[model samples]
Target: MDNNMLILSEGMHTSIQDLGRKGYRAFGVPISGAMDKYSAILANKLLNNDEKLPVMEMTLIGPKILFEDNSLIVLTGADMAPHINGEAIQMNFVYKVTTSDVLSFGNLKTGARTYLGVKGGFLTEEKLNSFSYYEGVTSKEKVQKGDRLKIASIEAGLNPSSSKIKVKSAHFKEKKLEVTKGPEFNRLTKKHRELLFSKEFKIDAHNNRMGYQLKNKFPPIKNGEIITSTTIPGTIQLTPSGKLIIMMRDCPTTGGYPRILQLTDIAINQLAQKKENDSFKFDLESSFDFLGRLVNRFKD
Candidate 1:
């Protein structure tokens, strides 16, 4: 019931993303949502908002905005060098913007995606129990220009906190992502698996809402008759030509051609932040073994 923010100039590809549309993949709807969840969760949690509330998920950079009323918001993930009314804003913290104040985000830094959580959830019409998924949607579209965002809270006289208390931060600290070996991971030649971790792979610029293409030595497989099977986000599928594609939040519900491996939850979040030329190592593990490690990770 709050009119806090309004989309003035929609950026290249900004979407109202939460987690994803669960339980509807069987109907051929891709799991559509934000690519990097770590930042998204962190940004929203700072404001004590629910995980299901839709937020502005941006790739590379964010769009310009003009507030309909005074609001406080927080930003997380890669720094995109934002500015408010020609005054630069800080990263990884919460700040305030007033009505008619213009805000712009520059190019992305180290990572690919960033999350911005306003005082409350971004209020968009819920279509099919979600504002996240945006395929075959007749009611709510992804997001368009001149759209008025319905927020949850209002400010009688609330404005940017003048005290200027800096926001503290948390360490993502995730590196050397673990993976569950694929159905065709063993099918590749012994040298292929060796080369996978042996050399570093660079993320390609051909990335978008769908997936990221990783470039490396390009492995080979002898027998490639794997049936068309179910695929999910974080699935690392390899083409016959040996190119690796890490399915993102908007990834297809299913695929074929045999995936090489599956990135764990922690790893996929970090992978979503990677832009072109970012290099990282991949570690292979058994499904049960990796799951146990993840369970332990959450415990700690």
Candidate 2:
């Protein structure tokens, strides 16, 4: 396995990520991983790699790289116009890259992030048992132009093989995010609760891996102050100033704001791919339907 990729240019923010660090949140470690887990897993599935294998996660722009050795690769998530040696390549399809072949991207067609999965996952040092990158947690938080990613070495001659899988294009077009009542959902006034589900919320310009700030001001909950309790991705916090903050993959482990709503796993995945300025409505789901949504998310 002499496969390695030389980064000719780092696009926007490219990093190596797997599922995430699972057990370190008790120590205040954030679970940082691919923003679009569905697409990341799809890339791995096409390569026949482990579902949790680390892949290159890129936001908006993508990196320019030169393959040092022949290898199989797949791209998923956002339709970043990927090209090999100046030729355009399609998403969700496994392709073979010859030595010295350069990979680059053009305009982002849809979604916010993209995932690149190599046949053998990138060989990178891990922290807290996860390849997911986070500042202070990983030696290198983001991919750099001069970085050389270590990959599995391959023999000079091997039979070529690849696969293509189609996914519902509707997933990328969905604008309604289903959410369940949060711990503090009842603390809001009845009218405010009604407004929450009725009002349209646009993603603010401050959106990042940490979280998203909703453009609309949420009605503050009575006695909104609370001890910094355990928090996770999808926890919607309503601040005293009537602001809504939706936790994301790199969000802090705890928060003091009132958690007014909790996005279902499906909603989190959907919101993860959403970019700034994108608007969405919260579709409140019943408890019974929430469980069914959870089951359906994994089924896909």
Using TM-score, give the best candidate's number: 2
User: lDDT for each of the candidates?
Assistant: 0.73, 0.88
lDDT of 1 by residue, 1-300 (tens): 246677877776777788777777888887676677767877777666786667787777678888776677877777788888878787666677666777788876556666778877777767666678475753555456787777666557655443323332322334466688776677777777778777778888788778889767385566554678988888888887777888877778778878888888778888777777877888777667867887898994
Best by lDDT: 2
Q: TM-score of the candidate numbered 1?
A: 0.87
**Compared with the true structure, what per-residue lDDT tens digits does model 2 show for residues 35-143?**
7788888988888889999999999999999999888888999999999999999998888888899999999998888999998788988888999999999988899
Candidate 2: clashing residue pairs, number: 4
Please list all clashing residue pairs in model 1, or write none if there are none: 112-273
TM-score of each: 0.87, 0.95
* Each model's total of backbone clashes: 1, 4
Question: Model 1, which residues run further than 4 Å from truth?
Answer: 1-4, 138-142, 155-175, 285-291, 294-300
